[model samples]
Every structure is written in structure tokens, then in C-alpha cells.
Target: MLKSNFARFAAVGLAAAALVSLGATAANAAPVPTEGPLYVYDGNGILIPTAGHVFDWNDNISASLSATDMAAPFHCSADATDSYTFLAPQGQELTRSAWQAYAPNGFTAEGSKDLLAFTLSPYQQTNGTQGVAKVNGGKWSLGLACTKDNGVNYASSGVWWLPVTVEAGTGKFTADPVGDPVVGSPATIDLEATTVPVAPDVDGPLSLNVPVGAKATLGAAALVNGLSTSTGKLGEFTVTDERALSKKGWTLTSSVADFVNGTNTIDKKQLGIKPIVVSGTAVAAAAQVAGSATGSAPFAELAPLAAVGTTKLNADLTFVAPKDSVVGTYTSKLTLTLASK
Candidate 1:
């Protein structure tokens, strides 16, 4: 239910519109509610052209731009070719990307956190069992920017963005030949089908056997040689997918709370983790994150698999406490989450 607002528009990497700064205020002030795909927002007395858009996933979502038409929105000139592109913010889990090409440009709106949402529905898999599918589809983004000069000598740019949900499609066709069609006269048949993208299911109601009472003695405070480390025995994680017909994949995520002992504290980022699949039918280990991640880097503590099957995941934990720290026993909680992609 939260919205992430973008900052001034700039298509530096997407296309050749880097000079088109949306933050360039015009010499004259314009009133708000300016009609068109773009609108003038009277930020105090500085007018700014702003816009928003939405698109569907798995489809060739695009928009045509003419210098003239684009100029109208931002009150610029149509003297040059319009610049445009669909920007995919880096570090975002695109899953099944639909962009025609990779867009290297991205921007972080103030206070914007990478947010994602999905709607699931119950359905029968091809194997004749119950399964879930994404109804609204996954989220992504599209970026647009264009600018021109006509004596205005000022950059007028606008942005179009919204939460886009893309869907995958499977098409099949059959030829209903009419009485043995000849080479010149071929039979014509039509085929059409629409279905939901099968959602992944977790084989859980299980638990990771994380070791209890993990300890990391500070290098200076270690009794038997200054070796400081704590290993966790997160119980064995098992992932079993009986639906061989489903193509959905999943990821196991690990996040932790800050280690704290009264007033003394250790950021969760200090805890290193490396998840690996010791035994599995079809599963791959995620890259070792080495204890570093933010909301934008969700994989710092994660286990990712490509194939569908039963797999057991485990992690190597190294809790490192810095020197000059309190001597109290700090406690922290570790959490593991399984999600479908």
C-alpha cells in the first residue's frame, strides 16, 4: 500500500537524453493542473512537468514518442529526435524480464525502498494436484525521458512510471487442413489460450536446525588463543517439489536481527553467512554474501536454486564480534524464508 516516488527525470544511460534535466526550472511560472500526458506541478512557485504510467508483464510494452508530441508535455521544442527507453533499476529481481534490451540507467527516489507485491491464486497443476499461481503478476518498471530546444533554452523533461505486472504466455497452434491442402493453398488454423503462471510452493512445516548458544569471543578476549568465531547449525532445510510439470523456481532467504547484549550492539550486517546445498535432487547454492546486505541487496543471506525438486539447504555461519566490545553475551535471532520466483 506504499508508493515510491521518483526524483527528477534523467535518461543518462537508457538513451541520449542525459542533458534533459527534469529539475531545470523554467524562467516563467506555470499554474498546476496543466492538461496533457504531463502536468505542471506548482512546487511553491517553480513549475515542474510530471507524469506516471503502468504496463503489463510478458508483453512488448512500449510507447511511441515524437519530438513534437513529447515537447508539448514538458513545454520544450521538437527540434531533435525524441529520446526514450524502459529503465530497469539495477539490483531489482526482474525474475522474467521483458525489456527488449538491458537499460543501464537507474535512480533511487528519495525514501524509496525496493518494494514488491504479488497476488496468488489456487489452481490445479498438470500433474493433477493443487498449486498456486500469480494473479496480478510480478512487478517491474519502464522509464521515459525526452527534451528539445526552441529558444526556451531550458530543459523540460517528464517522467512516466508505475508498478507494472508482467505475465508469461504459452501458445500452441493446430492446422485444421481443409481436405488435403496443396502447397499453394495451405490449411489455416487458429489457436489461443490464456493461463496463469504457475506459482512455486514450499515443502515446509519444517525447520532449520540452527545450532544453539553460538559464541564469538573477541580476538583480545579469547581465552584459548585469539580465535574469534561462531558456527551455527541451522537445522537441515529441505525443499521438495512434487510438481515436475511446473517450471517455477524458488529462493531461500536468510536475515538476522542485530546482536545485542543490553546496551552493547552489533549490526546484523556483521554476521557472515554462506548457504550451500549439501544434498539435493535439483538445487544450486547461492553465492556467499559474507555478511553484507541492505533492503536493496536481499541475497546477502540467501539460497537460490534454478531447477525444481527436493533439495536440502544449509548455511555456514561466522559470527564476528569486533574488539573493544562489551563482555556481555549478546543474543540475536536468525530467520529463514522460502519464496517462489
Candidate 2:
């Protein structure tokens, strides 16, 4: 349900925009219900109101649209194509993006494909306010053949109105005060080691890196009550993409060898990991498959880090041993592969 901030506008004078309903069907002009299968979010990641929202600026790269592929009653089929065409207030079509894969129910992101960026520049909002134009983030065609299953499909145009208010964002931000610190005579100062060293000026290209000899600690392994599960942390690494704008996107994948100690061996599948993006926006981490535990999940190649620049990456390590296995020191090698797209 729409919690608050819902300001309804009469569908009163839309004659110039061609005659049609405000919703999916011509007879119904109301917005989709909160429980609707299709949901659209604004550039700030907030659910767009039924009547849509007002923006202070255009060129929003954070906007995304997602629709659920229903099952059972409203089987909208799997992997249906979703197309969105933003329309002008005068009913002229703006831009359109047609993606083939519709998300499964409750799926926020698939693999490294999470957010969809959008923009609406040259909108020209003046005099405090502008249009209440129709911007259909997307429309679901929900193959009607499956409606025989007695379930209704989200076959709406899923259109949202975008009105611009330029006056709301006229204020400029002030900088915070900064000054030198004055230490009291009684203050104690300890000299800590620093890693800042002089380096030659060089603009390197794409690179996968970690500080030299920077190894992570995965605490000692021990068996307790015949069930021994050791969890560890992977060292951090940096991925940099100084490539041209055309070659910006990249993917990161990992694979581990079997943990072995002479005659003892632990399957690589028994050792799972939890991938994490320490820093970087638009860098998603659904590349991990965690079922019961944090590190006990399958990791797929995902695209988050190195979106256009650098990213810090890490993963949680877990080793689940089989019952009656011999106890001994074991070791494994983890390999991370990076590729440009």
C-alpha cells in the first residue's frame, strides 16, 4: 500500500495526450495497487508513487525498473521481455529500452545485472514547475495464453508521470570548516609505521591487484564434536579499469582448488565463499550462492566491481569437512579471474 505522500491529481484534462485510461486498460484510470507484480523505482531507489514523482533535475543514472514473472495463478511465463517507452505529455514517444529477461518473483538483481540507469535531459522545467509527462519505465506483455490458469497478469503499460520542480533545488551546499589541530602539552604521541612511498608518475591501464605479500588470516582449523567447520576471510584486492569508455565494464570470478594435505583431501565444493564488494557503487555481489551459512555458497561470475574505475573486493571463506575425515593441516589456492566486456 502507498504509506504516505500521495497527492492525487484529477485525470481531468488529458484530451490532448490522446484518449485512454490512466492505468493498463482504457476503462480504469487508477494507478496499480501496491501488491502489483511490477514495481518501478526512481533514480534515488525509492518506489515511484502511484501518480509518479517530481524530480529536481534530469539525467538520472540510478533509475531502474523490475517486474516479477508470476507463477501458478498468474503465470506470466519465465523470461518474458519487458519494454518501456517514456512518452511526452503530448503523447509522443521518448526513449525505449527492451530487455528480454524478466526477473523471477522477489528477485532484486540477477548475477551482476542489478540497476538500470536512465536519463531525461533537456526536459526544460521552468517557472518553478514543468510537465506531468508520461514516462513508462516499462510495460509487461505477460503472455495472455497463461491467464487460463485463472491468474491475472500485470499487463499494464506501467506508466509513471515525471514532473520537474527546478526551484526546489536552487540552494547551494556550504563547505565544512577545516583547520589545523592544536595539541595540548600533556598529549602523548606515538609514531606509527606508514606505507606512503614515492613512485614514478605512470597511468596504468586495466589491472587486478592486491598489495604485495598481503595475505589474509583464516584462523587455525579445529575439529569439535565430530563436526568441524572453519570460517576464514579472504584478503582484499583492487581492480582498476583505466580503459577507454567503450571498454569500461568488467567481471570478476573466483575458483578454488581442493584443500589437501598429503593423503587428506577436501573437495573444493565443500569450501564455499561469500563475495563482498568492500567499496564501489553499482557493484553488485549476488555472485555468491549462500544456502545455510555465510561462506557456504556457490559463487558465480558477477559484474559489480570495476564498473568504470577501481573497486575493493573481498570474500568470506568457509570449509565444511566430511565426517570421519582425517585431521591434518590442509591448504588450498584461490584464483580470481577478471575479464573486460
Candidate 3:
């Protein structure tokens, strides 16, 4: 009976040891540690949850037809202000600092604000969109903000639909006289805009006709002529012949005279005057003629009497011709004077 009792006690001790080992193994097989719930605060110190914090939006972004001109209108104006609205998910607000607007490569924003205004309406749990606004012109981009826990800001930006209704007006340029006249003569023409912009599109191209009032003037004409005397006389004589003539009158004025006479008494008349006799006898008698009259006459004939006179005439003349008169032929009417006794 004592041996049986010892065996029973040993068996009971073994069972207790097995139970302790099983409990230790079970404790070692426990699952890995996990992170706790997320809690974040915004710049405004607003508490935001982690799991259900999602941003939902409904946008009615629109573009309208604007003004058109010489160039295409890419800008939006008050007349063609685009209207649109967006709704944020419940319990979410648009980050004011994160809002941004963009335009096409060449287009630009003109207004100061990207969003007109953000309002909290009476609609419970409803996010209100902003009012109508204008873009300078061209392609555009819209960006919104989402900050759930404020740890790191979230951003969403994209290009909205392009506004195709607006267009640029065509332009044309013209002058009064297409061709040039005289170099100095000016042709007159009116420069006008076929279509003026009553309501200008800030983005649309403006058409302007820059009228160029220009003219090509002609240079003064030149003339050359050969001058000669009617008489065969060779000795230098005044150039009395008037040749240089212009619309403004004659420029050159002077008379030339040449004469030759023999020693024998010669009778001649000029300008219908009485004949005047140049007596060689009287001249020879006065000079003491020792040789025959014929011989003396020959010696006297060697030298003849000569006289010349020149007078300058006025250049100023009154006629239909003017200094800057048109280019054309002109003629002068005048009288010549002579002395005879």
C-alpha cells in the first residue's frame, strides 16, 4: 500500500509539470504587437481621425465664350466670367493656403484670387463651392488641398476643360494710295478698324490697324545745253544769249559783241541809223604821211578800231512758273537793245 501511494503521488506531480509546460508554450505563441489608432491635428489645431478621414469632391468647373480680336482670346473677363462650384466630403474643409490656379503654357491668371470665396452654408454636413471667377485666358489648371491629420498635406491638381466658345477677331491693314507718287508728294488714306471691340476679352488678341502714312518723293530734274554765238567773230565777246531758263525764270543774262573794220574810209549803218564814215585820209594827214596814200592806207589798215560792251540782266522774272512748280517745258519772252549813231 505504501509503494502504490508513492507511485500515485509521482503521477500527480508529473501531471502538474505537464500542465505548467503547456501554459508556457501557449504564452510564447502570442501574436505580434500592433500600432494604436491615429490622431492628428491641423494648423488650426483641429483634431482629425485616421480611418474615416476621406475627402470627396463634386466640381462643376466651367469656361465660357469670351471676346475675340486680332489674336486668339485665352483670358476670361467679367463679361465671360466662368461659373463653377465644388463640394468637399463631410467634415472636410478646403485648405485656404493650398488652393492654386493655373493656365496653359502661354496663358496666365489675371485676377488676385484663385477661389472667389469659401462659405459655410446652412446645409448641414454639406461643403459649399465658391462663386464665379475669371481667368486671364488660355488653358487652365485647378488644384485643391486635403489635410486629414495634418501630419503631411495632401494635394490634387489637374487641367480643367478648355473654354472653346471665345475666339479672336481677324485683323486687316490698308493705306489710302497703295502706290507711291512723286518722291515728296504724299498720298492720303484713312486707317480704320473694321471691327471695334465693344466688350474686350482680356484673353483674346486685340486687333489694331497701324496706318503708315508714307510717301516717296522725287528728286529735282537737271538740264545741260551747249552755248554759241550767231556772229562769226572770234575775239572774246559777252555771253548775251539767254539760255538757262526755268519755270522760275532765266538764270543767266549777258550780251557778247565782236567787230572788224579796214583802214579805208568805210560807211556802215547799225539799227537803222545814218551812215557814219571812218576817214583814213584824215587819220593819215594828222600822222604826217611822207609816203604814197595807198602805202600809208595799207599801213593804217594793219590796225582797226574796236569796242565791246557787256551788261547783266536781272534774274528775277514774273511768270506763271513757280520755284517748286511741276516738271515741264518752259519758254521766256524778252526784247534785245542796241546803240547806233
Which RMSD values do the candidates have, in order?
Answer: 26.9, 25.5, 39.5
Tell me each candidate's TM-score.
Answer: 0.31, 0.36, 0.11
Largest TM-score belongs to which candidate?
Answer: 2
Residue-level lDDT tens digits of model 2 in 1-341 = 21222332111212222223222222222222111122234455554432234333343322222322111122222322332223232222211111111122222244321213223332322211123221232221211111111111322223322222233233111111112111221223456786632223532376789778666656776765556777778877888766433444666767667778898887777665777778764354554432233323333233433335667788787676778667876777777777765
Q: Which is better, 2 or 3, measured by lDDT?
A: 2
Q: Runs in model 1 with CA error above 4 Å? A: 1-227, 281-307
**Candidate 3 regions with alpha-carbon error over 4 angstroms:** 1-98, 101-135, 143-146, 150-152, 155-341
Worst 10 residues of 3 by lDDT: 5-14
* Residue 267 Cα positional deviation in candidate 3, in Å, after optimal superposition: 99
Q: What is the lDDT of candidate 3?
A: 0.19
**In model 2, what are the clashing residue pairs, if there are any?**
73-151, 289-297
lDDT of 1 by residue, 1-341 (tens): 21222222222212221221223433421111111221122213222222233222222322212212322222222332232333333212121122222222222233331111111111211221111112332333343322223212212333333223344332111111111222232234567798643444534222333345543332232332343456564445566654444445555566678889998897776666666677754444454343463312233122334445556766566666655656667777766666665
Model 3: per-residue Cα lDDT over 1-341, one tens digit each: 11110000000000111101111221111111111111222233343221222211121122211111112122222222232222222111222222222121212245411322121111111222221112222111121221111212211221112111111121111111111232322335556678634335432211211124322122233331221101111111121211112111111211211111232221111101111113211111122111111211111111112211122211111112223334443321222222121
